[model samples]
Target: MKAGDPGDCAGYRIEFESSGPLLRVRVTGAGSYAATVDYWRQILAEVQARKPGGLLLVDELQGPALTAGEWQSLVDGTRQQGLETVRIAHVKPLGLQSVEHCEIYAREVGLEARVFDNETNARLWLRYGGA
Candidate 1:
């Protein structure tokens, strides 16, 4: 589905594409804190339900940075997929230093997560499994 495709997926836009063993997820336009949490809950459930491939999260949202509880909720919700050793690559939003904060949190939660300056690099790393 395209980014503009509709399915009552909260206020954010999410699209998933697969390239070999890697999964590319493009996210744009964030919503309120609660809405954002709900969106991730649904999207992660969908992604995990299908296949938990290497995840490339191309976030273009400009919403507020996720709070500690929200981030933990995100980690917890995504973890329900039972994904083991899933390479998580995130494309940092423009001017958002908190993107790195996400990386830190993901790692602390035992997820192999990294932040990239761009989508291309993020996908490449996910495909290659390293720099």
Candidate 2:
């Protein structure tokens, strides 16, 4: 969890913490999913441009469930941007069902996304840059 104020993009307030080439994006909260994604698309574009091969750790906690289209958006966005990320650690959304569903979709589409219950494990994966 991030403290203090973060840079706001659309409805999503983000904290960008980096140790050299590794970047971690902590999304604290969002006003709306649609607006958040809209902003995320733009933010991701910038990230892709700025750091192509850097590991990205995205910590999304207690977030709303994502629709199929939303999942597709992530899939398409990563593919379109050709973001060859070293690794992406996504802290699981609240609730087991949501986490399971998200994991299933990720596995099916080869999203290269992993969901974790806490930041500790997620951070470990990001630190190691491997599964």
Worst 10 residues of 1 by lDDT: 1-10
lDDT of 2: 0.56
C-alpha TM-scores of all predictions: 0.77, 0.67
In candidate 1 the C-alpha lDDT for residue 123 amounts to: 68
Model 1: per-residue Cα lDDT over 14-128, one tens digit each: 7666666666667666555676666566556656655656877777767677676666666766664644557788786565545666677777778888898887777678777
* lDDT per residue as tens, model 2, 32-130: 456546645654755665573343545453456767666665555555453444455666444433444545565565655577777687767766757
Model 2: residues with Cα > 4 Å off, grouped in runs: 1-5, 52-63, 93-111, 129-131
Best by TM-score: 1
Q: Candidate 1, 27: how far from true, in Å?
A: 1.6
Candidate 1: lDDT over CA atoms? Answer: 0.67
